[model samples]
Target: MSSQFLVTSRRDMEERGWDQLDFVYINGDAYVDHPSFAAAVIGRVLESRGYRVGIISQPDWHSAEPFKALGRPRLAALITAGNLDSMLNEKTAAKKFRSRDNYSPGGETGRRPERATIVYANRMREAYKDVPIIIGGIEASLRRFAHYDYWSNKVRHSILLDSKADILSYGMGERSVAEIADALAEGKTTAEMYDIRGICYVTSRAPLSDKAVMCPSYEEVRDDKKAFAEAFKIQYEEQDPYHGRTIIQPSENRFVVQTPPALPLTTEEMDAIYELPFQRRWHPMYDEAGGVPALQEVQFSLTSQRGCFGHCHFCAITSHQGRIIQHRSHESLLREAKRMTELPDFKGYIHDVGGPTANFRHEACGKQRISGACRNRHCIGSEVCPNLDTSHEDYRRLLREIRQVPGVKKVFVRSGLRYDYVLADHNKKFVEELCQYHVSGQLKVAPEHVVKHVTDLMGKADAQAFLKFKEWFDEANRKLGKKQYLVPYFMSSHPGCTLRDAVELAEFLRDMHMQPEQVQDFIPTPGSLSTAMYYTGMNPLTGEKVYVARRPEEKQMQRALMQYKNPANYDIVYKALCQAGRRDLIGFGPKCLIPPRRLKGTRPEQTPQRRGSLQLPKKTRRRDTRGRK
Candidate 1:
């Protein structure tokens, strides 16, 4: 079992009695030999195929010597910015530096250098000038094309180009990485593996592929927001593995060509990947600094599936994992549960038993595998597709089996659940089981917005679906004799959201009596449909104008409306209500969101005069989606 972990140092290599490694994996995360970490998965995959892989976890960026800790590999150096993009790890939407990094050991901050992938690649190049560098993971995957970087506030070139790497494996890289390793082992140069699907590489000359879709050049996207949006739309439509086209993005000196996404692993292949002998814990080297905080969430949690078809515009899962739901078999999950029971830290509780969406245990529909997901229509948004298979019998049965495991006491599903899909199910047994066994009091659901127009732009199901699910949840708890609650999540200042829209959302929240502890201020991360809307002020899908709240004050007002009950947000909420002509909501009425009185210890005369344009509120009563007045 000790030898199962890949070599990380000269001592480990000597222990393994190996002369040299085939690949040296450089990651900006602490070494946690678990599948949840990309370094572990890719390393284990390469090892399973008879390749010797070494790991360099969060090497010091100030010097090149840290990159050469394991010496040079026999073949290539594979790098990932851990499980998250490094810039996002270091900074927030307001561009403020964060104080802690969960992926780092001891939850410390600033362990990895900024722009981690590029930084790591450059450092490795400094160490070994001629070694091939292959970069991937969330950072490289999302930035494979010219992208709008929130931190830099400008379009940046592909990571492959910026990092000067030999190749960039965009999506799930198991198949492509294996093929690259094999090709390299067979005396092929990294540049010759450009034809491999799921990888992007830079070339000095234009690509000669006949089936390529040429995107707006980097200069064009940099100069024109509309051109950027158009290029994003093209990339978005071609993400399907079955029907995706080869995409080529041009630059002045070279071309960045991305092959179509790799085909999804079959159920058997997914089972094999999970069945790999992952120690399922952080490497012992991290034990002294209180271990890796990131593994705590996933240690007891079993990932029964991969990928999501929910297709939320703001989510990057659709772009990275694809819309197809590739799930593990019941036997594989049960074995994993048994394995968890044997672990010394097992607390008789399975923290979670789900993936991106909890209830999705199979493909969205019958034709998804054959025809690929519908690019034009969402499977479960706006309206549930007629072809949508909303049954949860398999998932329900799997949970039942896990509950019966000898050492397991309770199992919870803490991952995001698509409630609209629950509403579409006619069987209704899964909801009962979920409430009876899975939910830990409050079930978290993402109903991003209540306004139909806002939801339409966000590509989410209508609020009525959420309303129906809430009713079902309430009734289920009542029948089961349980005291459970629903914790609905909301997003503020999304594309197309206005001051009026925020006010409407506030009214809906007031009716529901939900004062969320946290509110997500929309951050435009690259490779998402919503980011395209944020950048262009137009729907990439429709090319129609959308009102985007760009001003910091306007964005603050919208976020304030979500938690209007908080005393800190009173001024912003008051001004927003007044500006949106909803002054009727300002008085001391029970329905009012804020009080008309001034703050404590302040004179009434101190209250500022109301602006003349503040229109009198209308008397019409609008029923919420829950049918509440």
Candidate 2:
């Protein structure tokens, strides 16, 4: 099936004898097929204002044919947004690695899109140089600054200048997209729309015209790559909405795009986005052709909420969704669950259901609508703002309602739950409910690191908090008499982690008798605050000196500490100790697993003689002088 983007510069131009349109919205991948949803939302909002609009989803956006497919209309203005590309790239482990020798017939290689969202914007520039192209979504929003790319292993700057988009919107696109559509429809120039919240555009002339916008200097963020990488690594490993940090806005010109008031969608509006007749399989085309193996057949995913309250130093959710949580109604969630149960190959387990933070319900502490933009990105960081409310009463109701859904024999909170939020709540009922109903034998939570200093740097819960939560969880499980186990997630070699810190973690693990199977090395993703710290040894926001474990040896030691018993780790630990010149830890120091002599080698005198006769040892044993005298 061919997909096309619907765009026109003129209102009713197609109806008024125009043959084609001047603009087209391009997308990067097929999986994140939400351009259509955004388009539908924008179309509905515009129609409410008596403006004509059409929506389209161009899956293979690289192909120029889609631009022509949507019958051309007299041009007015081009508006592009939300999803520009699949943010998941080769560097993100989205693709399986295959060797050339292992290549087989009909096997696809290099499935990644050739052009990034910025590259697509550049292509659009080539096709329609004068047309307005707005870029948004994870790609454009995050990369609107100079940052490092793990795939190319190099530094990059604002995607707007690179992709050649006229303007870049930096957050959720519904409200912004609607405003842009209306403004353009009303004949407002692109320059007039500059002040819109969440939009980033380059000025035709500026004192710093060469730069896209006045953002934090690359030098400020350059040395912070390791820190940022570590932060991103923690986010991916935990997938816990509560455990992330505020990813810094790259540009001073870039203020966060705030989410509109939770437009409590009726069940019908919820159905519109979810009930769209589209392929839900992991790979729709591959499945139909029987190319997907049986192992790939069963896959599950769904979104329950749209925003988060717990913002860590390394997260972008607050910037994207705002601190206020927007939840899909319990009835809507139940309907989605029912739909999942009716799937042709439905298994009893629903893979996961969640949004930015799983347990977040749209309800706030009081009925008052919180106003004013958030100065800080995360609400639940070191200091909770007076305006912030961390209640979960409504979330509890949602979970209870979801559990009662028909045909859903079991539900799994596979994404993640904010253990800190659960622990902080006035009641322990949610924890009890989770233990008894939601968990599928294992409950995953991210206590990123055991070191307090490192956890503080990462804006995560300290050891004390994690320990308390663990104790509560254990007790809850025992009380329920359930077989569920808590799978605590951890990160290694984050910014602020030193060899000594790693050793401390090793000691902590040994004391707890916890053996971890997964240990993640920090990978710097583009456009994160921690990535800047990881690359540079200073905080991008504060410019304060921060510790970073960049050396391979230091990183190895940190990883080894997580897996002390693995023989591979023993080699890593020994090598790291030798590199650090801390020979004391090579053998069993308080933290070492290998004995000291085992690492330093035995003395000749310590070796046993083959025969009973004294073969003068390299160093003769001391004689009993008093007895001899």
Candidate 3:
């Protein structure tokens, strides 16, 4: 088969001699035929299964004309809100319109409509009435159940009902989409797909499955915070594939049924998906608009794995990809590297070679493959589990093999690396290899915070583990005669973080001589555990009260504390110090975070230890001068 992009227009379809499409995949992002993009992955997956897939990227949702570009698909209309949630893509954390969208042509903003899945699905319905519509991707996946919308600042029903989509395929849809396509090929209706795994559907009178667990109804969660917390806890717990159960939630007169996640693809299965004929770049139609900027970061990258076992509360990987790690085979990855070298744009650099968590190539523990992750326990948290196989030998070897590829000069791991897990490994070879080869002068790791109390709430591992990793990282660079540094990522204003905690974190930064280029304030995006805590002021897992900086001023102070050295944050830092009873940090002392303003001076100045001690004791000064002479 030709390694060309799937049909995007009628001309392309006509060229391929296709009378009708097997699936018309609508996406909120620009057409990028790379594997990293979900639309590309699903379209290619269907094509690989002998289905003629047509892509409608970033359609004009204001009318149905754009949806008619590919005529009508024979089987289903697959829709997704791109790789990111459309609301997040179009707006900032402050709910202001973003100026640029990397997913669009030339990074233009507002190219796609907000609430893209619903808008696109509605448009598809208008263009091809009676066509079965299937919604998936991050937006539909995260909001598969009743979810809180940060932009709207209210709880909303499942996207299925809003989009009028026939079926909702959550998580990685390669497996689910294939099954759905095969079933549709066999002349099955959307109603029969209700029993499919990793899918969701709505019904007015149909009863939920016996094995399903029901969440707090939309009315209950919307009216009661405690009920929302309880509902989110159950949803979080039942995400594991091994022990997860179908979940159902009700809104008004209908019920939304979400089946358990699809089982992870085996290594061979994963390799086959990646090995599919992908153009590996955005469509040529985008060339005039400077191509897709999103492709720059991933055009040369090789995805070695999928899924993450490090279930951070702020991350949606657990809710989307699940905690099970599905890695590609070494042969598969090496072949990709070789193929990348053949591209005309190839310059002998492979940008990245990892997934959600870089070093995770295998399951967390042996038990996970059989019994699944423990319902209530973390794989590597305050302490690494005894069964946690923190080995990097395979990862190290894989890197070596890729480095040996004929035209590959460098391979970097830019994704999140669990330093705590790296610390657990006694074999220091991976750390040394990382410092010596993979690092691009700085390795970004999310310690998130230095304080144990704050990190615990963030689902980060022990604070001491980060310190240990820092020590080993420094030692490795010293032995290797390299000057690479660890750029630790920290989050401020997270739940359970107080002003005092922010001050403590600032002091830690001072001690480390690190001034972060950027600090993230906790964003309560929907569906994550952190958002649950932000909304309810309680940790859903434990039902314990959490200290959330809800006030705008308080949140600003916490964020300002992270960048305390910035001139713009001086006032907020000063106010925060005073509020925390940390006046000692406000003086002109060497360790002070901010200098004090002289009562009558035009600008702030250094102050003596005491009011009358400005002269520095003439006798002591003379004695010091005499010693110097």
Candidate 4:
């Protein structure tokens, strides 16, 4: 383990000649000093600015005593719910408790309490009422507004108010966090730090500026679906950092003010952030409990970029990281690769060099920085934006440089790719090189759904785009004499998807002779356009009604349709087909999805087999023998 790991104990602080620290970072995950972990990134960012920061990871939330492990900080304490929302980390799409947690030590669950930000905040307040609490990370960032909560089946107020934290920092919070720390150091109160962008706070009075947009209040939206939909539309459109307005929402006795998003860091600034001295490993104290499971994949991988322009409706990346794409320079990435090689357990492989969309290293257009992402339109829609830059030359160059790094034998680009953008690119060389060098036999692309209505609701290109990309991918691999395949990820039970739509997707898969092993069931997580639609049954943008699958059985049936080959899902698939009026598809013909029922006298074991086609014996024919009959 690297000795450069962050201090987790008071003894380590004393060894460094420090009796007290400036900021103590309370994290929901077990300590892992890797950049991919938000806890480590924020800690390192503060350390780079000459602040003494100690980390306390996954402390006991039962009492205030555990939160006081690091004692009182000279300044304030920063908190995060690790890399994912606590509810998301602990529960599955089906709302069942997950037995293993990737962010916890030894893949153990129950290490952190549910609604961890709220839980930790309460404990911290109990321990020291005067210490200002600044909460960020995925949980607090997405829930910063009054949004839908699928777990509880209702609308909830801003996490900032719910947790009663002094300030809530949203998005990739490097710049805003610095402003916060500086203000606290200057003896400024949280109330005085109102001008900082990318943060939300409670104020007794209204925002002084008339430019602020007052969305539906907590009371109005919680009770009225129309008000909720309108508020969500306003929130979705104003995500741009430049053109966005200061949004205020009234709560019971006060108001919550959210400033415009923070501007993205420049290339040089992005480089400096990633090049910070990080141990890139879980703390050795976790060595006994085996290491934090989340670090294993990212310890060797590099996050060359942050933020996504795709803005998929189901994803929280846009709300948490903001829209504009930010990336590191080639030189900085190469430096990180060299350091990875120096580790004792280092293999010759570099697992991934991608972010939300691996191939989208450049912004959609040059005007993004000058103005902002378009107000109500998607950068990608029915047609690729004419102004969109589809060139992959920069990405190609970056990959070439990393492959030449000494001791790095193989490099993989395992992150999700926007096939729509790739298909739009005129250059075939990037595609060819990717098939030959970067891929280890399979490349993952997300088409989400096949039906136009469903894909439109998902903010994805239509299925034809994926088909064309697959054609090009096959051609590229053929030219290189390689046998690479594409794994297309699909989802079920999103806002606009109904039983009919799921059956359409299942039939599409059947025609393609593909039965996917895993299917993604959409969970209406906070701060997403799809979640608003799920809760209100209306498209926030257009005010048109949308079909929502809120029942547990319906959602399960939709998921089962995608993996219809599984015998355990047979009953659900049959019920789904019958419900969708697709019983015509339930035969042993060439296009049949399943075999006919047991014929009233067949053996008990006569069930559909999980084979290439999942088809059982075809009914024998008295067929076409009309003349003989």
The full ranking of all candidates by lDDT, starting with the best, is 4, 1, 3, 2
CA shift of 396, model 4, Å: 0.4
| TM-score of each model, in listed order | 0.94, 0.72, 0.94, 0.94
**lDDT to native, each model:** 0.84, 0.53, 0.83, 0.84
- The clash count for each model shown is 0, 39, 0, 0
lDDT of 2: 0.53
Ranking by TM-score: 4, 1, 3, 2
lDDT for each residue of candidate 1 in 1-26, tens digit (9 for 90 to 100): 33367788899899889888899999
- lDDT of candidate 3 at residue 342, scale 0 to 100: 93
Give me the overall lDDT of model 4: 0.84
* Model 1 spans with C-alpha error above 4 angstroms: 1-4, 599-629
**Model 2 Cα lDDT, one tens digit per residue, 1-629:** 11322233234455555455433444333222221234333434444455444433333356654544454323332333323223333323213343311011123334334335655566555555566677766666666655576555566655765676666766555556666766776778777876555566655333333212232344444555554444334322222223322223333344222112223333455445554433344223334434422123124556676655565545555444555555566666677677767778777676666765676555334432344234434345444445546667777777667667787777777665777766656457777777888887766666778777787777776777767776776777789886666666666777888877777776676666566655566555555455667766777556578887876667767787766666546677766666656676556466665564343442323232222111111221111100000
In angstroms, how far off is 445's CA in candidate 2?
A: 0.6
Write one digit per residue (lDDT tens) for candidate 4, span 1-629: 33677878999898899889899899999988888888898999998899999999999899999888889988898999888889888887778898788888899999999999999988898898999999999899889888888899889999988899999999989999999999998999999999999999999998857678999999999999999999888888888898999999999989988999999999899999888888888889989899888787778898888877777887777777777888999999999999889988888999999887788797889988899898876777456778888888899999999999999999999777787887788667778899889998777677878999998888899999878887788889889887677766778899999999999998998888777766678878888888898999999899899999988999999998887766667778888889999999898898877765634433323332333212222221110000000
Of candidate 2, the 10-residue stretch with the lowest lDDT total is: 620-629
